[model samples]
Target chain A: MSRKLNFYAGPSVLPVEVLEELQANIVDYQGNGFSLIEASHRGKVYDKVHNEAIALIKELMGISDDYSVIFLGGGATLQFSMVPMNFLVDGKVGDYTLTGTWAKKAYTDAEKIGKVHAVFDGKDKNYTTLPEASSVKPSANSAYLHLTSNETIGGLEWKHWPETGDVPLIADMSSDILSRPVPVDKFAMIYAGAQKNLGPAGATIAIIRNDLLERCGDHLTAYLNYKTHTKSNALYNTPPVFSIWGIKLVLEWIKKTGGAEAMAKRAEKKSALLYGTMAESNGFYRCPVDEKYRSTMNVVFRLPNEELEAKFLKESEEAGMLGLKGHRSVGGCRASIYNSLPEDAVSTLAQFMKEFQRKNG
Target chain B: MSRKLNFYAGPSVLPVEVLEELQANIVDYQGNGFSLIEASHRGKVYDKVHNEAIALIKELMGISDDYSVIFLGGGATLQFSMVPMNFLVDGKVGDYTLTGTWAKKAYTDAEKIGKVHAVFDGKDKNYTTLPEASSVKPSANSAYLHLTSNETIGGLEWKHWPETGDVPLIADMSSDILSRPVPVDKFAMIYAGAQKNLGPAGATIAIIRNDLLERCGDHLTAYLNYKTHTKSNALYNTPPVFSIWGIKLVLEWIKKTGGAEAMAKRAEKKSALLYGTMAESNGFYRCPVDEKYRSTMNVVFRLPNEELEAKFLKESEEAGMLGLKGHRSVGGCRASIYNSLPEDAVSTLAQFMKEFQRKNG
Candidate 1:
């Protein structure tokens, strides 16, 4: 069967190969008499899948033994709470860069736990750009610096990261993780919800440096405390067995298809093709985010009016394209082409965009 | 291909029909040209699935309009903390009945958030029996009474619920949800990890009465806040979409196969056959749990010696019967016969038991 062009922001597309693999193993995993979902997380079958998933992340990202790769549930929203619950103590300030919707929400979530400082705010520019790296700085004696590496809502991403020096750096890399090469050692911790650039929802991956485990407080509940997860290897209580297995397969696919470096090259090509078309649209179609900080994963653009935007979405859906509607918080159009999205699909979308402009411009 | 008789305690068996249905749609859900896991949670497809799952739970359990069914991630361990975070506030005593390992863990988790009272402790009896209904009582000013409906560890189940009077009652029904008929209105709230009788191991079902939403605290993080989840219909964040879809299928299966009433009858028969065989052994096999309170879900038993117990597990696995090994906390034989366990499998287990005893007697 022919697949639809999936651009829906997340619970988004997965590699066709990954989906096929999951299909093959859905009933019985490797001739095991039971389904993978029926297998115990503590059992031998899942232990291998769990370990391989962790190993693949380490290998693909060039991560050293300094980090522990963990699979968790509750998506990036839970991580928004956990990062502060673990690192931000009563006496320490947690520095945050408010780049877009997710970063702002993360900053808000942290406020419920302890003191947090928004060191930089991009909302002043309607979340169209990132903070200048030179002006960004963690507060004196701050517990950690937090930022969203990519914001799906406004189609914004940080082209350059801030230098936190001695302070630990944390990022909500939910949209951008595994889409390109990342320097694992530069940041103290990183987390991503698995729906984008990975496998599916249900699982969130956390890559935390070993030293950060010390900052986990006593008042936190067992599941809320990162130390409990780290110590138990993310199996403290049945760590989303099926989703972790799905992640393992997606990670293996990532490794086999030439690691993060290869993904970076692919992203550069895919984004350039789509962005070039938008750039040449002669203001018929306009991108909202700044050119330097535009997200390669989610491309946001707008037509002349809401009526035309509505027409664009209707025409695109009829042509077998899906999830092109922009985030409700910031409406217009968003074509989120994640790692699993083929380059040809984006080219098709660009061609469609030009045609739509000719008819509606 | 023949399926294995899965008897593992939590992350346990699902219906073979459910597995086949999942396999059929693993790649293209209803020929939509995309995997269900790849569908957007906010999209219409997932919205239908999300609503159907909640509706099925309410219908099957005979739940009234007063209760709301919410799906959350991070297993029942998260609920252990969330129960207290929402309801166990300061100046109010949260009463707990320590029936088994999980109940003890729930009590420990609640202590991290607020004042809790252990109304009854079963550890004195090695967690082999539930407190008598007459002997158990909640505090006069208790906020809510919490208990484990079924304990997977020692195979103890509450034969009669404690009288909490006007105070709210909460239960962690992780291992035995949908295995029997439950009076939903009798409890203020119920939460179950979805690895057992439900579907898979990522999503958890939270059935909270409308009034329970008021107990959610303001200081709690967004994901931890019950009110936040209830207000948004559990879509405050991108939910564990695939797991929730799987749950919808399982609940559909339960409804089609004569609902929870039929499941209760099946449990009764399966548990009787296993326990009766143990009873007829005449000291050859000894069940650890008290006769009256022995769980219909998990049947924990011991042989004359550890040597025979090892032999039992080895031979059982070789004979295509798996997960007979009891929990490590209590070293004995355990056969968990959940709702999906076929009657023939239990008969096969019984046959194995009789033959093993005859050879070793």
Candidate 2:
């Protein structure tokens, strides 16, 4: 059977090489006598994998000693709560820019812990574009400024980061991390769900600055405390061994296929091809997100009408292009061409989009 | 290559059938056009898996409608905090039994959240035996009474559950959840890390009664609150998809091999054989845990001396018996025989034990 082109957002798509390698070693990892999943986190095999996953993140992002890269569970959603619970202490306000559903969710989580100040909310504009950097003015006593670097549902992304001088910046890069070269030093903390650009759905990566560790709450549980994890090297509990190992392999693949810079170039090509097709469709296809803020990771567009949208989805699915259907909240079409999505898959979608438009128009 | 007789504490042995099935479908899950890991948690494929996993737990344990089986992350450690955070509210004391390392750890986590009362302590006896059921009496105003059903490191298992009427009973059943039949209704909530007797190391299974969930605090974070997770069907976030899917397969295997009853019978036979062998060894093999409270899942023992113990471990590892060494805190040897550990593996270990005694006794 032929491989289908997967375009699902967050639990998006992984490189075939990573999957093949994982499949080959699923039972016995390099003849270690047990599957990576079955290996104890405290043991040598899994310890190597755990450390290597961290090392890869550091190497790929050019991360310095000021930060600690941790592989956590419960996805980025857990981090949404954990970040605030740890940092937003003693009535310190967590300043947030509401770019999409996720940013708003993070704000909700922050409200549970302490004071929250919405620096800017894009929902008034139907979340069609990110807030300008000039418009973000956080409170003087704010603990940190938070934003969603990319909106999976709204298909909006920050072309440039908002300025939050002296207020340690935090970003939920769940849907777009590692897809391109990120300015790691600009943010005090950044987290991403591994399902998107990393490996699978079990692990979430948190790259936190060392000074942020000092801001953790006194009453935080051991598992919830970022400092506990940082001190224990993320072996505070038996970590998601298989998920972390999968990440190590994926990171190795990333290094082999040139670094983050190379990934950025590939993403640009795929996004440009898909977006260019939509732009030239003569009102046949419409992208709701503002052109400047359109996500390179998730390309959201619409056909002429609901009938055409239905027909397009059915036909594309038949042609083995899965997850092309848009998020239910934003009903249209979404071609989530994440980092691992080959250029050929984007090319196929672009060609199909034009052909379908010609027939329907 | 021959498969090693793996016996590590956690992230331990899985059924060979489950491993083989996972390896085959690591890339494409049941020809769903994408891997189980690559599928979106919101998609139909994952939705089916999420529901089925909950159903399987209920079926195997004979759980009633009053309970909700939740797939969570961060392992049982998170539950240690979550249980207290959710239940120990409004100045209510969390009553705990300090039975082993895990139990102490749970107590530590609870202290972070609210008032904790230690009903019983086992460290006086080197954690060799669980407290007598009759001796465990919680405070009348206790919110809940917590204990570890099986101590993986201490090699102790509760022969009878402590009576804690009205105050909800909670247990960390991490080491031996599905290894034998359990009185599900007796405990208001039970949680286990899914590395032993279930699946891999990413997902955690929490079987919580609805009444218990109603007791959750209003101030809890959305992800940390049991009410939030139960209301969302554990879809409060993107779940550990691969781990949950593996659990579905494991539960199916458990049912196919005759459910929890058959597992209990098998555990009895395996434990009897190993323990009986030790008993007949004329002080050659000494088990530290009291025979009445000895664990069928993790059997801890020692040889005549440390030198002999060292030699025994080396020889055993060379003969393909891994993880025979005991935990660092508790010196000597530990043989963890979970549900998936075949009778032959234990028999092989029993035979090896006798032979080693003959050589060096």
Candidate 3:
């Protein structure tokens, strides 16, 4: 059977080099006559894997002493609840900016545990435009100001994070993290699930500022507590060993292949190619999100009608252009071009889109 | 360099066959000409992988229509809190039996949510024995009775699970699930972290009785809610994709080699051989747990003194036997012979144990 191109929004692309290393060790790792999957997470080999995962994250992101990175279980969803459960206390409201579905989920979870305040809602405009960061009214004494850096559902990106100052600026960077250069100094915490750009979806990465670490309220479960993870270096019980190991490999890939800067450049080039093709289709293809808020990763666009959209998806699938269907909420097609997506795949997708539009018109 | 024999407890071992399949997918998966790691979670390929995972779990365990299986994030530790949050309501008490570290953690979480009646504590016997089922007295109109089927830390295994009759019997089978034949009909819910014997640490399998579907208590976060996962078939959120994929491969390996019955028989053989070897060493090697409660998966033992134990561990490491060190509380060595551990590894370890004893003696 021939290899197939995968275009999943997440649990998406990975570097070939990393996968090859994994493949070689999958059956028997380290010449131990046993597969790496069968290897011990606590042994010397995995200790190196675990330690290097943290180190690599730091090295690539240029994380400093003020920031500590921990590999946690649960997808980005768990952090939606955990971030507030720990940090939101002292009766101060938790400020939220609703840019997309994921950020709203994060806000709703905070509502259950703390006083929540929404700065703006992109929903009013049907999420076609990002909430203006300058217009956000962050509370003076709020526990934290939260935002979704990239709204995967809406194809909205925060070109600049709102300035929350001492009031911890928290981000759910699940989709856009590591896609570009993120200034660690700007936020108290940045968390991302290892699906898009990073690796497979087995673990999450939380980079937290040292000061915010001490503010977790009393009711935090030890497993969900960042302090506990930091204390044990994220080995607070049996961790997701293989997932972390994969992440370690990925961070290494990111570092070896010219860091986040190189990835940001590649993402720009690939997504630009696809979006530019859509723009060239005129009225046949119209992107929903405002140009200023357009995501460099997820290029979501719509056709003349639902039938045409369906036809495009079907034809794309036939041609092996996968995961082009938009999220159900958005009702269009989204081409998520994360970091590991090769430039050639985007070119192929763009060519298909152009041909389809010409014939349909 | 030759690969060292690994024997860590959880995130321990995987069948060699699964690893080979994983390796083949590294560069190009199913002739897709792309790495499996880069494949989309929602694509045709991974969709099949997801269904295959669910089918394998259900088929192997002989699960029926009355139960629904869910693959969740956060490992067992998150479930420790989530179970109580979603199931244990206000004014209701949940029954708990404290067998080891895991059960104790569950009990601790339950305390945060509702009144908990701890029926039995293995701490009295230093966690090496099970508290008899007859000794348990449930709270009136209890939510459910929770027990740890196998305690990894204390090397404790229950020969028979206590019958809860009409009440739900929730078991944390994290360590020894699927190692032997289990009556799927006996429990209302069973949760296991897939590290010890399953495949990897990132994925957790939960089997819930159908009747418990409508009983989600109020106040729990929607993402933390069990009903949400059941309705979406564990794809409510971005699941641990690779872990699920690997688990599917592991399940296939199990089925192709022989089903759970065969796995049980193999477990029995390895345990018996290791026990036999330990016995032949006279007073030099002694397992802490009583004979009747001995685990077929993890075997914990000790030397006469701490110095001798240290010497044994060093010699074992030199002989390529890694992760023989036990828990900090136990202060000895533990050999966790999970499903993927070949009997030959046990034999090799046994040979080393005798050699070390001979040299010291």
Largest TM-score belongs to which candidate?
1
DockQ score of each predicted structure, in the order shown: 0.83, 0.78, 0.61
Kindly report, for each predicted structure in the order presented, the TM-score of its chain A compared with the true chain A: 0.98, 0.98, 0.97
Task: For model 3, state the Cα shift of residue A204 in Å.
Answer: 1.0
The weakest ten consecutive residues by lDDT in model 3 chain A span A33-42
For candidate 1, give the lDDT of residue B98.
88
Clash list (residue pairs), candidate 2: none
Candidate 2, residues B3-74: lDDT per residue as tens digits?
A: 888888888988888989999998888887788888888889889989999999998999999998898988
Candidate 3, residue A177: the lDDT equals 85
**Candidate 2 error regions (>4 Å):** none
Model 3 CA deviation exceeding 4 Å by range? A1-5, B1-4
Compared with the true structure, what per-residue lDDT tens digits does model 1 show for residues A205-324? 999999888888888889999989989988899888777888888888888888887888888888888788888989888898888888888899988899999999999999999999
Candidate 1, B44-127: lDDT as tens digits: 888898999998888998899998889999889999888988898768999999888899889988898889999988878888
TM-score, chain B only, every model?
0.98, 0.98, 0.96
Candidate 3 global lDDT:
0.82
Off by over 4 Å in 1: none
Worst 10 residues of 1 chain B by lDDT: B157-166
